[model samples]
Target: MKKIEAIIRQETLDDLKDAMLNTFEENPIGMTVTQVLGFGHQKGLKDYVRGQEVITSFVPKIKVGFVLEDKCVEQMIDLIVKTCQTGNVGDGKIFVYPVEEAVRIRTGERGESAI
Candidate 1:
């Protein structure tokens, strides 16, 4: 099993979710979304108006995570990349890792089956 974490622009969340749902079976994957603040090389800055400056320190980003079968990793990554790409800064990132184990709270099922 593998865990895929994709940090992307908030605008792309709906598209990403729809694409993933179309590709996977109902509830075959579990997902979570979080709001995060961050900055990259271009970092945010303050905007000045009427001789006053307003600090804008960080960029808003959406982080999406899901657990899926190892075999599904490549496709899932592709889907995310395609849906999230904006050809601009702050498109965000994707991280993948191996899962040691997973458990179903109600049934106590373990391993890939639990996911």
Candidate 2:
């Protein structure tokens, strides 16, 4: 199994979810999203505070992730990239990681079935 994590622009949530659901029709895909703040190459954003320039090192972003079969990781990443593209910086990033295990508590299912 693999875990796909995509940090995307705050405004593209609906579009990304719709596109992913349409693609994963044969099997249901579930994901979790969280609001996070961080900085990367863009170094965050600047704002005016009391007539003075202030640089904020942390910017808001949406983190979307799900654990699925390893084969599905690449496609998921591609969809995220396509949906979130804006031809500008801070488009965000996608990461894939190996998942050691998964468990469904209520059913006591494990492995791919648990996912």
Candidate 3:
């Protein structure tokens, strides 16, 4: 199993979700979305605070997390990049990690089935 985490522009969440659901309709794809503040190469955005120009170090982003079978990882990444890419900085990043285990609290299901 793998855990895929994608940090994307706040505006792209709906399109990404719709695309993922349409492409993976054969199986249940559970995902978690979180509002986060982060900065990378772009540093941050310029804003006027009391008429003074300022660069806020942290910018708002949407972090979407998913745990799925290994077979789905590549396709998921592709969809994320395709849906979120805007030919601009702060479009965000995607990460994949090995999942040690997964468990369903209600039914006691484990492994891939639990996911």
The TM-score that candidate 2 achieves is: 0.92
Q: Roughly what TM-score does model 1 have, to 2 decimal places?
A: 0.89
Per-candidate TM-scores read 0.89, 0.92, 0.95
* Decoy 3 TM-score against native: 0.95
lDDT of 1 by residue, 1-115 (tens): 9999998989999998888888886655768999998888648757898999887889788989999888899999999999999898778889999899999999999998898
Candidate 1 — which pairs collide? none
- Candidate 2, 85: how far from true, in Å? 1.4
lDDT of 3 by residue, 17-39 (tens): 99999999989699899999999
Model 1 residue 109 lDDT score: 100
What's the true lDDT of residue 47 in model 3?
99
Q: Rate the local accuracy (lDDT) of all candidates.
A: 0.88, 0.92, 0.96
lDDT of 2: 0.92
Residue 92 of model 1 has an lDDT of 87
